[model samples]
Target: MTIEGRHVVILSGGISHERDVSLRSGRRVSDALIKAGARVTVREPDEKLLPWLEQHFEDVDVVWPVLHGVSGENGALYSLLRALEVPYVGSRPTAAMLAWNKATSKALVKRAGIATPQSIVLPNDTFRELGAASVIDAISKGVDFPAVVKPVEGGSSQGVSFVNEKAEFSRAMVTAFTYSDGVLIEKKVTGTELMVGVLDFGEGPFAVPPVEVVPHSGVYDYAARYNAGETTFFAPARVSEAVLAEVSELAVKACQVIGLADVARVDFIVDESGKPWFIEADPIPGMTETSLVPLGIQAAGLEVSDVYARLAEHAAARGPRNTPATPNLVV
Candidate 1:
C-alpha cells in the first residue's frame, strides 16, 4: 500500500549507551520513509518529546522508535507512546518489556516449547546481600563453563562476556553489572550462532532468511557487532536446507509466543543435532547498515525501505492501543 502523505515521527537517540547506534538507525529509517513517499521527522527524544507528541498528535500517523539499549528496548518509551495515543511501529509495551529482559524472555521462549540454554538470573543485591563469593560458588555449581554473562537488558552486545573458566567469571559479572542491575548467565550453547529476523508487514508473521554470525575474535561482543569487518555474516547461514527451515520456523514461533508485533529478530544457537535454541528476541531490532535485520531483509529479496514502509503503514492502520500502564509492564 502507498504510504504517501503519511506523517511519521522517527524517535531515536535517547540517553543510552547505544545512543549513537540509535541515531544512525533513526536516520536510515527516516530516509526510507521519505523515499517511500511519507512525510518523515527524525526526532531525538528528550524532555520535550511527550509535549511534542501531545501537540501534533492529530497530524502524526505513526511513530517509529529506533532508540536502542535501555532507553528504547526497556518499554518505558513505548508506554509513553501508548499513553499519548500515538500509533507506533514495533511491539506493544508489555511485549517489549517482557522481551527487553533476557531472563524473562528466555523463560517465555522456553515455555513456548522452544529450547533455550540453561540460565540463571542474579540481581546486584543478590551478590551484595548474599556475598559475592557465595553467589559465585553457587553459580559455579549450577551453570557449566564456557558460559555467557550479560546484562539482563540492553543491546549491541554491550556488557556481554564469554566466560571460559570460573576464575574469569568475576570479571564477567562485574562487566554485566556495570550495564544493568540484573545479570543473565547462561550455559553457552555450542553450535552455529544465527540471527533470524521475523516480520509481518500485514500478513501473519514469518521468518526472513537467517543470518549466521561468525566473529573473528570468536566472540560476538559489542566491538564485533558495530565495528563491522570484525565479523563475517552468512546470509543464508550456510546451514543445510532442513536446518534453515527449522530455524525459520522456530523464529516465527518465538515471535508469536512472545507477542511481538510488526517485526522481531530472534537470536539462536543451533546445536549439532539441528535443534535451534532461542537465545533472546529483539522487539526493536537495529536498522543500521551493519545490523542483521537489513541483512535478513536483503536475503529475503526485500529492501529495507520497503519493509520499513510496510511496518509504518501497518501501524497507521491499527492506530495506538490505549491502555493505562504502570511502572512495570512485564506481567
Candidate 2:
C-alpha cells in the first residue's frame, strides 16, 4: 500500500491550550504528506467537522489527527472517528485514553517492569474538601521534595511546574489544576531528558533515535517545547551505545504495553546511575518544526515525508476498526 494519490485529511487546531501547536504540527504533517505525493486537506476539529467528514468520507483515504491536549489525546475524538468507521493514523481510542492520564500510564508501565517515578493523583475535589494546605502538607511529608507537578492529562507541557521546595508545592498544584481536574505529583527524577518516537511502518514498531532535550531555562515547559532556541535537542542523545539501545527498547516496549499503534513518543529521564525511568507516552506526538519526533527522524537518516506517508499507508491497509478479515465469513 502507498499514500501516493491518496487523499489524507489532517485534523488540527482544536479548542485547547495547545491549539497553536496543533495547527503548526498539522501544517508540518500536511506538507510532508504533500511532498510524498499525497493530496492533503487541513481541517480543524470544529462543529461542522463530523458533517464534513461524513460528506467526504469516501474521498479520505486516511485521517491523521495532529491534535494535541485533551481534545485529541483523551480518546474522545478517536472514538468518534472509529464510530464513523474512519481509518486513522494513531493509537486506538482505548490505548489513547490509557496513555493520556500520566498517573495511569505510569502505574501500567511500572507494573510491566518499566521504571517510573513515584507519584500521587490528587483530584481538585480532594483539595476543596480536605483543605489545600492540609493536602499539601500531607503530600510534602509523603513524597520527596523537588517534585514535578502537572495535570494528569495534557500535552506540550502546559500547566506543568517543577517545585524545588515545600513552599512551591502549593503554587505548583494550583497551576496544574488549571489544566485538569486532577494533578499528578511525581518524584522529579534528575538526569538527562530523552524523547524517543515509536513508529510502525507495516512490519513492526521501532524506536527512532532518542532526542536529548536540554531546555535553556532548565525546564521543558510549554514555551521551551514550541519555541525555537528555547531548548537544545541532541538527536541520538549523547549517551553510551548500551544506554541508547536500552532507551530505544524501552520506548518501543512502553508503547506496545500501552497498545499504541502507528505512531507514538515515549519520554524518559535517565538518572546519574544511567537507569532510564519512564516519564510518559504521547499517542499523537507533535510533528512541528521543533518537535522531538521529527528531530529523531532526521537524525536516523529518514525523511519525515516518507515516515508520515508510510504511517498513512499502513493505516489505510488496516482499514476500519473491527472489520472482519473475510467479508463473507460469519462470526
Candidate 3:
C-alpha cells in the first residue's frame, strides 16, 4: 500500500496546554507525509474544525492527529472522527481514554503483570474534603520521599513535580492540580529513563530502539523535553543488550495491554538491578525536533517519512470505522 497522491489531514494546535507542542508535531508530520508524496493539510481543532471536517471528509484520505493534551488524548476527538466515519492514525477511542489517565493506564499495565510504581490517586474534590494537612500527611507517610507528583492526566511534563521532602508535598499538589482535577502521587523509581516507541504498519506491533533520556536538571520536565540542549538523548539507549531486549519487550507489552495501536511510546525506569519499571504510556507522542520517537526511528535505520507514510497507508486501507469488514479480514 502507498500513500502517494493521497490526502492527509493532520489535526493539531488545539486549545490545550500542549498546543505549541502539537503544532510542532503536526508540522513535522506534515512535512514527512509530503516528502512521501502525500497531499497534506494542517488543521486546528477549533470550533469550526468539526464542520470543516464533516464538509470535507470526502476529500480527506486519512487524518493524522498530532494533538497532545486533553483536547486530543482524552478520546473525545477520536470518537467524533469515528462518528464522522473518518479514518485516522493512532489508537482507538477507548484506548485513548484509558491511556490518557496515568493512574488508569498504570493500573491496566500492572494488572497485566507489569511492574509499575506504587502510587495513590487523589481527586481534587476528595483532597479538599479530606483537609489539606491530613491528606498531605497521609501521602507523605504512604509514599516514600522523593516521590513524583503529577497531574492524573497530561503530557509534556507540564504539571509534574518531584517532592524530596514532606514540606514539598503541598506545593507539588498545588502544581499538579493546576493542570488536572486529580493528582497521582507515585514512588520515584531511580535509574535510567528510557522511552521505547511501538509502531505497527499493517503488520503486528513491534518496538523501536529504546532512547535513553538524561536531563541536565536531573528531571525530564517540560523544559528539558522541548528544549534541545537541556537534555541529552542516546538512541538505542546505553544499556546492556539484555536490558535493551527486556525494555523493548516490556514496551510492546505495555502498549498491547493499553490497547494502543498504530504508534505509541512507553516509558520505563530501568533500575540498577536490571529490572524495568513501567512509568507511563503515551498514546500520541510528540514528533518535535527533540522528541524520542523520532530518535528511536532513526536509530533503527528507518526513515521517518517512510514510517509515517506507511502508517497513513495502513489506516487508509482499514478505511472508515463504520465500514463493514470482509470475512476473515485481518485487523
Candidate 4:
C-alpha cells in the first residue's frame, strides 16, 4: 500500500502535562509531511476525537499520534486506533501500559538484564503516614542522596526533583505526587546523559546515533526537556565505538523487550564505567527542533522530513499491532 498523497492525521495537544510540547511536535510533523508532498491535518484530542476519526479515519491513510504522556502515550488511544482499523505509529496498547509505568518499565528492563538504576516506588500514603524517614531509609539502603524523585507514571520529566538532603527528600516525593499517585525515587547515577532514537520501519529496529545532552548545572528539569536553549545536544555522542554499539544494542533491546514498535526513543545515563543505565523509553518522543530524536536523526544524515514521511508510509504499510497479539504482521 503506497501512501504517496494520502491524508495524514496528526493527533496532539491533549489535557496532559506535555500538551504544549505534543502540539509542537504535531505541527512539526504536519509541516514536514506537507513538505514531502503529502496531505496533512493536525487535530487536538478531545471528547470529539472518536467522532472526528469515525468520519475521517478511512480517508486518513496514516494516523500520526504525536501525543505525549497519558492520553497519548498510554494504551487507551492506541487501542482505539487499532479498533478503528486505522494505521497509527508507535507502540501497541499492551506495551504502552508497561512502558508508561516507571516502576514497571525499570523492572522489565532490569529483568531482561538491562542495567537500570535501583528505585523505590512510594505510594501516597507511605510517604504521608510512613514518613520521609521511611522513604529515605528504603531508598538510602539501595541508593544514596542526590537521587531523583518523580511520578511513577510520568513523561517529559514532569514532577521530577533532585533530593540532595534528607530535608528535600519528602518535598520531592510530594512534588512527584502532584503528577501521579505513586512516586519513583531512583538511585542517581551521575554521568553523561544520552538519548537514543529507535525507529521500526517493519524491518527490525534501527537506532539513530545517540545524542549527548549537557544541561546547565541544576537545570536538567522539565523545562530544559521541552523548551529551547535549556540544553546542548551533541549528536553522534562522543564515545568509543564499543560503547556506542553497546548503547545502541541495549536501547533496541529495551524497546523490543517492552514491545514498542513503529518509533520510539530511549534515554540513558552513561556511567563513569561507560555502561549505559536505562532511564525511560518514550513511544512518542518529541519532534520539535529542540527534540533529541530529530537532532540524532539528522546527525545520522537523514532529513527530518524524510523521517516523518517514512513514518507515515510505515503506518500505512503496517496495519494494527494488537490484533492476534502479533508484533510483526501485515493485515
Query: What lDDT does each candidate get?
Result: 0.87, 0.90, 0.91, 0.82
Q: What stretches of model 1 exceed 4 Å from their correct place? A: 322-331
Residue-by-residue lDDT tens digits, candidate 2, 216-270: 9988988899898999999989999999999999998888778888889999999
Estimate, for each residue in 1-331, the C-alpha lDDT of model 4 and write its tens digit: 4455888888989999888888888888888888888888788888898888889756878788888879888788988888888878777787877788878888878888899987788788876797768766767667677788889998988899888877777678778888999988888889988899998777788899999888865557777877677887788998888888899899998888887887888999999989899999887888887888888889889988888788778778777653223233111
Q: After superposing candidate 2, which stretches have Cα over 4 Å from the reference?
A: 322-331
lDDT at residue 279 of model 2 (Cα atoms): 96
Model 3 spans with C-alpha error above 4 angstroms: 322-331
Which residue pairs of candidate 4 clash?
A: none
TM-score of each: 0.95, 0.96, 0.96, 0.94
Q: Write the per-residue lDDT of candidate 1 for residues 1-331, one digit (tens) a residue.
A: 4688889999999889999889888888888889989999888889988999899988989999998988888888888888888888878788888889888888877776888999999999999999998899899889998899999988889999998887888999999999999999999888999999999876788899999999999888877888869999999899999999998999988787777888889999999888888999998898887789889999999988888889899888877783222223232
Among residues 3 or more apart in sequence or in different chains, the pairs in candidate 2 whose N, CA or C atoms overlap within 3 Å are none
lDDT of 3 by residue, 109-155 (tens): 88888999989999999877989999999988999878999999999
Q: What is candidate 1's CA lDDT for residue 192?
A: 94
Q: Is candidate 1 or candidate 3 better by TM-score?
A: 3
